[model samples]
Target: MALTAFVCGCTGNDRSQPQAVVILGAASTKDLLSDIAEAASNSLDRPVEIEISTGPSHALAQQILSGAPADLYVSANRQWAEAVVDADLAEPAVDWLSNALVVVVPADPTVAVDRLEDLASESVKRVAIAGENVPAGIYAQQALSYYQLWEPLSASGKIIRGHDVRSTLAYAERGEVDAAIVYATDARLTDGVRVIARLDPASHSPIVYSLVRLHGESPAADAVYQFFVGDEARHIAERYGFQAFSVSQDEE
Candidate 1:
């Protein structure tokens, strides 16, 4: 009877353990995290408390490597997750989503900023972009450079800095910036923002999101890891304006 009671107690304790997941994420993933968390909670048979910190990819990576307790990381770019691997903090990075750069204006869409030249006009004075250290900001900078629009745009004194991609989008959505550059994923999050143009995906290095486990691993963490690349999570990703992971992306 003692042995039977002890075994039952252990089983109950195991069943009651909560699945704690911490995501040191980029701002771009904010739109779909709730849906992914819901599916993950169902799979783990425990409530999934996903605490996410949003900032530039580099800053988030440093936070994780510095020993912040994190179950996983979803970065706007693969490089930051790869940083975790270099620090021996996690496994090889996995690309969970593919994204493109986009130019956003106010939801009213009166600017008619349809081309690169349109952006250089004197009327286009202030533009909000992610800070240089941020992934989304870097992409925006690179695209501007490649198209030879950077200098003229910069000379307009309209380049404003957002802490991250989401902040940049917020600037445009709130009528704070005449123009802003953000990921296609960020623009999809709200009806309050409208896209002025869809940037060529090849305009810069591929805009990809990678997932990595932070701290040690566990079944809960693994489920969160898998959820980002699975059909359930992909559905959430699509709804949030990200391209679903191609089967080939899983191998990448």
Candidate 2:
């Protein structure tokens, strides 16, 4: 997803100090967060103008550390969120959502990889995954390693690294790679790709999305944050195929 910003609430010459809230989020949450922001604007009394910028969680954290303007930070994993908190750039992070990894192929099915093991087959040429430092890449690495395929695939030079999960999925969507490992939520957003298998949750570390309030106090930003952690946002997240942390906990 391109780094885009959507304005919510009122827009026009009536700009009597519209609260501007900047949110730096993980790439996969782009659409989901936009919907939540729209709902938040409608429900909140004060007019809020929210600008969301998204990328790999690790990169976003680094940007925040480098003084990027962000009132809130939503990470795809806890590690990057904690990094911000550790730098005193934000408050303690809270678990908000969960996701599952999936193996996706082109919609036309050019590759013969119907299963995870098929990734190792001679017919499979390239496999796309996010960079090693990215959350999706970390999870994919763990899952591939769990199946004992990481080393062989890595040695064969078949692993194609993308800057982020969305870009990784694009590799499969465009048929540039034989397949890709991405979030289930991401696969749902695109019609150019088809999910062949869902990786077992036990194969990797839990895919938890963590949110934090960057050190500051903006009523608008706080309101949006509250709405995000509230029930309404949970329902919206579910609609986007994300599992709310509360729901996952209940399942456990």
TM-score of each: 0.86, 0.94
User: How displaced is residue 176 in candidate 1, in Å?
Assistant: 1.9
Q: What is the Å distance of residue 105 in model 1 from its true position?
A: 1.0
Worst 10 residues of 2 by lDDT: 243-252
Candidate with top TM-score is 2
- Candidate 2 error regions (>4 Å): 11-15, 247-252
Model 1 bad stretches (over 4 Å):
1-15, 109-112, 246-252
Judge candidate 2 against the unseen true structure and give its global Cα lDDT, from 0 to 1. Answer: 0.90
Encode model 1's per-residue lDDT on 44-98: one tens digit a residue.
5434556555567888888787887887788888888898889988877777788
